[model samples]
Target chain A: MSLNVVSLVSVGRHPQSGRARRADQDGRAVELGLKLVAKALSVVHVGDPDDPVLRQYAGMGLPSMTILKQDKSIDAVPILSQFLQQEKIDIVLTGVRAESGESSGMVPYLLAHALGWPVVARVADIVSVKDGEAQVLLALPRGQRRAVSVKLPFIASVDHAAEIARQSAFALGLRASIESVESVGEVDRIRVDWQESVAKSRPKRLKTVKAKTAAERFKAATAKPEGGTGKVMKNETPKEKARAIFDLLLEEKVIR
Target chain B: MSNVSSLGISSLGIVRRDPRKEWIARNRLHPLYHEVINEGLGSVVGPSGLIRKNPHQIGFIGPNGIKRIDRLKGNGADTSNKRHGSAQEVVLPLHVVTTPDFYLVVVPDLVGGRLSSHDKDILGLAHALQGGMEGNGAVVAVCFGDVKETQFDLAGVDRLIHLTGTEFEGFTPEARVAALVQIDTQLAPQHWLFPDSIHGGTDLGSRLAASLGERPATQAWQVIPEKVVCRGAGGSLDIARQTPRIVMVLEECGNAIDETRHEVLPISVDALEIQSAHLIDHGQVAVDPNEIPLAEAEFIVSAGNGIHNWAQYHQTAQALGATEGASRVAVDDGFMPRFRQVGASGTWVTARVYLAVGISGAIQHMQGIGQCEKIIAINTDAGCDMVKRSHLSVIDDSDVILSELMQLAQEYGVNDKPSQENSPEESQNVA
Candidate 1:
């Protein structure tokens, strides 16, 4: 049986400029979803339908993208959950984590919980889908892949290590339409109350010191000394180099 | 000092001195500290007061001389102001009871018995609690698995709720999540913290969050009083929950705790029933203990993008009796196995000497070897980050240096005649 795969795409934000764009991982997810179900794939987003970044997905030749019109006050999980519930969706594909806005990396997990479906994270590739089970290659640390089989009607978050997303076509971008749907669920009061500000690089932490007396502890804790410049070696022969490396190793006790 | 009642049970255990030696071995028997030299790093001082001298650095000066104790030996340092002329009868606190508002659940690495470098859930939890709550309300830790009371670095925790059983053994996801759920229901903590690491943490946190009807923030970096801040696309985003119940999976917190305060709390063991699930197959994937012995390897020779011949690098590692490690790119290119990959996502090796070959140091790769005592880089790029990070960097071809190093090893009898001839294909790593 052909699967009904829903590509859950989100507008990614640029790191330095905070400009809305197609998240690299999410684009890869869209690419993967297209590869898996092809004509049956439906693109879904839970943000502004008129947002310019939504066109990036459409430019990838998606015929139509569904935008569940959720205001910033509404939680994406409940909105996406309600939207997905109305369809016979077999799989939900999203990026491992969103690049901007709440970036909890929990949307897929939350969706799994809300829909009572198993969720797999860091998915590198979908090996095969057969007999109500999907065999997948999970991306582990260090570029390793683990083969795991999960029963379908599941959610998968594509790993950054997956294939690069294809470039958006200009002609397709002109033709594709954003079908806006009514927002679902009540506004999440807590999310709406959250104060938003341009994020700055975090401040340096206070140095913790262990000392005998309170006075000495305070002195040591606040002492911010300049670190010494490291030594750079040059023009040494192979044997001499070997000896130097060996001595340093021995001093550091790398080898007995 | 008049404040005797404020100390915890672990504090009392310290007062019971070893009569044989006046100076206490500062470092406890946590598996991590077993191999490290305990002279400067251990608790060699007389039972004097421990102070948070510096971040991740603790110092106690006595007749034995000033010594820096391992920060991770015990729970957070005791704040009790006690001075001793010698090993006089030390006052020990019996029990510490407090109503815990925050719960830090430390799921044991059933495979390793004790938590490894990768699992810093407890540390992050403590930091978050101290940062947000200012250590006010109780920071209760619920440890699940065959973990002993002493195994955990319980520096900031107020109460330890240990759940251990034969059924709770191994990386049993269902049993572990069930146990945490039970604790959540019983304790009803305002904030719940889990390690946002790959090792079953994501699964547990997600399941627990779902079960409790609270959205969990995975890989959260900061925990303020009102919200948990995590890195999103543009910058950092704060995850604020309307209700009191917040499930958080922690990523790396910037600072490491000092060992000045070793407050060992009383342990309350609850044996939970085995909770079974058919979703994920149990006993399927088992990480071999010896597969990637990168942590314990004294010497490591790591290959990077520059090394085209991995077989030669592997042979060089065998010649020097060093563990073979690779950068992410090398592993990605299929030159080396993922187990041999070294970096943040890979093994955090505390090897005494790390020999880098042809690898430009990426920040992620540099994090893995940050703990290495000495780093020697051999890269053609003179200005690569690895060169700056290394103690000795040779701006030369790695192939020449490796052969020379192997020759030197053979001359020093480090590589036996038979061993020198053995190829990488004949012998495989124990991992």
Candidate 2:
């Protein structure tokens, strides 16, 4: 027996300009994350049957996926919790962070507590499991690693490193089916202590450092750091020499 | 150790979400926080159904190596918050010592393969606790302080121990628990508290439970004097059993009190010196309360997958001057960052004009954006869920209707300006 668990997806609206002009950004991340989830769960359900995520897998005649529909007003956490209990789910897995609202980074924690399941955050890999417990990898700072053992019927937040999630090609993206669900309770906005949204904008940090020539864009891209060759100001006095060194350092960010 | 005799059983564990290793202790087996890794207490089976004798022991751990906070400049900040004006008070890092088996905390240095002085301090603490003793363990932390913008002070403690090292920067969940396990076994405290940051509760809670011999709970509420009560679910056990007497802080429910005091004394090893901390510059912008606050917003509109070609909806957004988004589509398309997506990821928005243009109303996509006073959906298919769920369904083709609206807008003269609507002052962000 398997739990008809549903993968709840959510998004945040851009605080300022409400226009999305690119393609495949969500498709790639979602599709990749979905493949990772599939490797861990026995029965996976989705909220939107028509989602591009479902279509991606349709060609491979991949495993069955279900969708639940309701008034958009429904509070997902409660809805998901009730569904998990109702379906007797063994566990739930979601991303360490979603791209949208309340970026408070509270969902996985809240849901695990709400569903009464253990949660593993930013898990890199699920090593193995047989009798309720499992050994998993929690990627550490840098490329370092650590091995953690925990019990099952728990929640885990997957990191991009968990595994290279698979892709659903053109063929598989077609045969997915859309399932219908009945209406449920809807969660309305709780106007207590509203969080004001900061207008969102991407920070401009990229610097164009090309060695003077537009035609050499490709060459410049492949170029390595050109080692500087300059004599040390060892013979000069401390104060005068220090001033020159500081100026050079500022040009290269070698010093503040 | 202030009060060890009053120790009660509290299960503290990060949500254990490893989908693989199948050990009996792994079966909801909570790892100890402080003592297990320090002296090699081995392991034990708990009433929660975890039985582990695993050899991956946490050896002695402590902070070592004194970094005298440039005594000259430090002497001034130590007296008062006046002379330094904008600078925060300097506090030192007071960590117990440890060895390689003890796991050091290294930040950028560790990644770059250079161990910092703190890393060596970790070895010192571990070596001292280990005292030529074999096996892995961790130093116990009865209490620690926030060393924000400060020097690590060794004032007011029994002994100055060091297990400082480069490996001890921010630790992975496994390493954190590995180090904590030793401390848990050695010193089980009655009153336990953790940093109220995002990284703490997620894994730290679960690790504490496994080490401390108690079922730890996350997001503690009111501490009823002697007893600490927490609010969280204890997953895995089908049977109900009360393994009582422990306290934990709840999540996002309360503001964490700044804990900036802990005593330290240099035993035979001189002072527990602290190096200068990374400088910080902070500022705040005030928001005028009398604005078109989100709560007071009468009309709210959200976009989703239904709006295929954005150009088609230009006139629609312009006509209504509504904030637009998707059920996870526009967000991924770079039309916006994922933060703006309308489902489980984005804000839970609700207002008067809830319009779903070309949105399929997927659950994840809908959860964040679906709420509004009135939802009007325009899609070609009457059968689509968007048509069924919206307050008003426009069955005409999206391209046709949007284009028609755009033409009408140009004819009507209010096309290019979104500023013509309601209040110009409302256009600003949360600030």
Candidate 3:
């Protein structure tokens, strides 16, 4: 049976330049969807149809994309859920979090709750789909992975561990058609009270000395900071040096 | 005659001064002044019978043969004596909440059955919120599955709800969320704090928030009772909003509690309605070290252009069980894959230990490893930037070090099995 795979796309702000670009995880989601159902993959966006960033995602060999043209103040959850239900999408793919707006990473969960479907988060890959179930790999901390199986009609959030999105082709993106649809969206009321400003860099927590006595305080103040210059082994034999390195590896528990 | 009498008395341990001698010593030009005035004869009792102490006589001779006075009044001496004795364990005061007026619930991501640093930070934030409000508010830590953390009291947990069951173990977010929902109904905490980390905290917290239908503050760095400052727009913009019921906090949001201990009172829910799980977990997959991404790998062995024997470098990395990485120059030379390149231009790595072989660290390469905890550099040039940044540097040829390291790893693997067997034999011999 052919799978109805849909990838949600969003305009991303470059972290360094703060310019409009294709969202990293969303592009990966599209890449994964393309790998799964190549010709049948449908790309959907909830924001402006004229967002030039949308074309960059199309540049990854997409034939066309659908846009539910809406305003920034409106919530995309209701509109996207409605569209997904109407289309009867078997597999819905999205980035773990949007690179714009609140970036709360609640879209998939909220959508899953609304549709009564299970949502797999931080998915590294979908290994296979068989017997109305898909075998998925979830990314864990420190390069670990967990295998899980969820029934179809589920939502999966593509993780950074997934295969990176292919580079965009300018000509292919220009040739792809962008379909625009006017969808009614609810204005987010709770966000009206929020105050937004440029993020300030957080101060690094310094190692504090809670000295009880004057002598202890003096020693704390006079003590040299740790780990400044490294220990260089110049005259040691190769065996000794290798032993030192091996000891550190053992200390770090990197070796089994 | 008086000096002889005084010397006789001095032999009996009575410090009696001869008056005539003191007078002669006071008269500097007297003939016997040199004999009376010795090195330590600085102070003497007056005829009025008052005892006198010489300031010069109190101090001992220094290394330079000059007397040095200790102005600390022997406090330094007492401290030195204490240092030589056994060290004392410092115990912090306990903070108890008898009748909690409210609750600030915290769900820590106890990775590997222990409290991670991120979990401690969130617990700290929970206590800060509890302190900010009026009345006694208890910080409740709801831990799922096995707990190896014994310092929950030190981590500022006033109450603990440890849910240990097979249902709550290993990738069971659905069951865990159900338990949290039950706790919410029971305690009705004022706020819920979770570490905004990838280690199941964010996932569990988000799941709970969705089920509770409460909008949560994600990536919150600064939080107060009245307001919360969260990083939005992919950490570029700060959004200050009214304090929400659920808050997912970033690391370093508040200081970990070190000054006081807590009760760590164990609590439990009456009954939890665990929902049937739709997702089935198959446990963790065994991932090869080489297949792991360079950015996420905890241990990396990176090579550079100085490596002539690429096969040996790969063998060393394999033996060390480390992910392979490469310097930009190595990637440019087509000796390694582009994804293996580590620099500002390539992937930034946050490995715990980074072992660089022959990489004369470029500025970009240094930038990529900025978050690495320990770096070991093996290079011929001791003055290279990599050596300067590394915790341990070996000035030698890369080929020699790599070969030796590989041999050491192989021998260690061989030695481990025998050591385990020998331990049993040695214990039997002792018996």
Candidate 4:
């Protein structure tokens, strides 16, 4: 039997503006799902389908998406986990994080915990799937990639290094329809008394230096006024030049 | 790529430069410095001539209007040093180390099998937290496996708890989580701190948070007695945990305090038994030990995208006996491995001296080398960001300068090879 694959989608924010927009990563996850399962891929979302921001994602290749319409008070993890369990999904894919809101990047982990499946984060690309196992290339920092294989019934979060998602076609976006399903699950009761306020930039930290008197304090305060004093050697002896550099290394504690 | 030769002949290949003056001259502000001024936070210069950071004053307004004591300029009126009256002293019972209130769990780098600088920073933070509680709190350093307590500087720790067992070894997430969870159950520390130094820290922290049913703050930078200052979404977030049990993953806090002040005390060892999870067979990737000597090496030669010949850079590093590092660009271009990349997302370097080659200093890269005592920049562009951060800037072809430096080292018999005294086996935990 073919693998029952599901790709989770969400409205991502613009990188700079933090405005609600189509999430590029979710689209990439959809792309990966489509490559694996072709047209049989199921796209699921737990938020409102009417949230116009999701249209940008709907236009990117996928013809339809399922919205498990949930209340703001309801937690999405248990609902999604139960839904995936009911569908008996063999593989699940999602973006590493949502670009806005509670962008804790905890959904994948929480979902994996709920479903009792291992999660592979920062996946660059899916290599292949055969006999209840999937080969994937994991994205590491500094543009490096590593190959890792995971057993079936696992969750994978797409990284930015994944393929650039296909552009949203205006016509297709207009034609795409979102399927809404009623959410049935217990709401998270852990009260997070959020003191929502405009965040201010962190204050600069001044390194504390012991100054007995005001003179030393003033001098220390006005430090680094002079930029780096550089030397250009034209007719200096190699020994003299090497000695100078060696002194610098010693002074800097690079060489003991 | 041949842009180095494009400079006019009137200018000599090398020239003197002042980074701060150059920044002002070019009207390009250093991102960090600019943020300081933009935030209306007064800038403070340290004795080392580097700008120092000012921590946020936690939830209190002083009686005086000044938010910072450093900003106050004055000579205090001195009451004579001699005591006027008989010393009126209030007698109090001496403080004693007992059950730990604060726990500093140094998670080993599962892949590298070593301790990271951030782990030391977490220890320092735990020390500070313990002190803030007026010597009422005790600190315990927890390590998995047969890690030698001497590997770390346990200055502030009242007791060291070593989980001595072979099962603690290996890169299995299950084993680590089980060990930490079991420790938490046993100790029940009021506060738990984990250093977010390696890739595995986040996973361990989150899993612990989940199992404990508490949301842990990641990238925490500062700690007060009760609250932890964390890097919040878009800014700084101060989180106060109502429950006594709190877990936090700390960022690069630097080796601020001296580690050698306190004498080593006897540590209390606790043997923990954890249930092993089913293992999966898979391939693993390892970083070249010689490439990025972040914590161990004193001298580092780093390459940037402007490097025309990557092999020459490596040769020069070998000649000088210095560890090789790369900017994000060099690593991205596959000229260097991911582990060799030095920047915010990569490894934070605490080397004594850093030599940047053909690299434009990006803020991300600068963040990593914040603790380097001296930075020497060689770039074609004199006004490049990297040059501005360096104590010395060579405005010439880096390839030529590097070759000349290498020749000079050979002639002088510098022989500054990588230190054999510091090896992976020792795994220096004290940064």
**Predicted structure with the largest TM-score when compared to the true one:** 3
What is candidate 3's lDDT per residue for B1-431, written digit by digit as tens?
Answer: 12321222345433354666645644668886665544344557778988676775655433234554544322233323233222446578999999899999999989878988888888888888888899999999999998899999999999999998899888998899889999999999999999999998888888888889999999999999999999999889999999999999998888888889999998878877787898999999866776777888999999997799877887678778788888988888777767778999999999999999999899999999999999999999988899988999999999999999999899877233322221222123221
The candidate scoring highest on lDDT is 3
Candidate 1 overall lDDT versus native:
0.66
Runs in model 4 lying further than 4 Å from the true structure: A24-28, A136-147, A161-164, A211-256, B1-96, B99-117, B127-135, B144-151, B163-170, B196-198, B218-244, B249-431
Name the candidate, 2 or 4, with the larger DockQ value: 4
- Fraction of real interface contacts that model 1 preserves: 0.35
Candidate 3 has a TM-score of 0.79
lDDT of 3 by residue, A102-213 (tens): 9999999888888888889999999999989999999998888999999998999999989999999999999999999999999999998899999999889998888877
**By DockQ, is 2 or 3 better?**
3
Ten-residue region with minimum lDDT total, candidate 2 chain B: B278-287
- TM-score of chain A, predicted model 2, versus the true chain A, to 2 decimals: 0.59
Candidate 4 lDDT, B1-431, residue by residue in tens:
00111111234422233344333323434454444223333347999999776655211122233332323111223222112211334232333555444544444342233445556666666667667664356556666654533544433445555655556554455666776777777766667776653355666666666667666655555567665545443332343333224445555553433433332244553555666443342434432325334654567888998888665676667666677778988878777777778989988988778888888889999899988878887777877787777876666776677677777667656554444332332122111
Over the stretch A1-256, how does candidate 4's per-residue lDDT look in tens digits? 8888899987776657767777778888988888888877889989776888767767766678889998766778888888888878888899876664444456777777778787777788888888878887776543435667778888888987788677887777767888899978676664254333434454555567666567558868888756554553334544444445556765765442
Which of 3 and 4 is ahead in DockQ? 3
- For candidate 2, what is the TM-score? 0.33
lDDT of 2 by residue, B1-431 (tens): 10111111234511232222222122333353233122243567877889765454322111122222221211122322122322445453444433324321111112123322332232233223333335543322221221231222332122332334433344434444444454434343233334222433435544455445444433433333233333321111111112132333333222211222323332232223333221111111111112223333333345555566654554355453444445566666555444445657665665545556667677765565445544566555667666555545565555655655554445545334434442333222112
TM-score of each: 0.62, 0.33, 0.79, 0.60
Q: Score residue B15 of candidate 1 by CA lDDT.
A: 36
True contacts kept of each: 0.35, 0.01, 0.85, 0.11
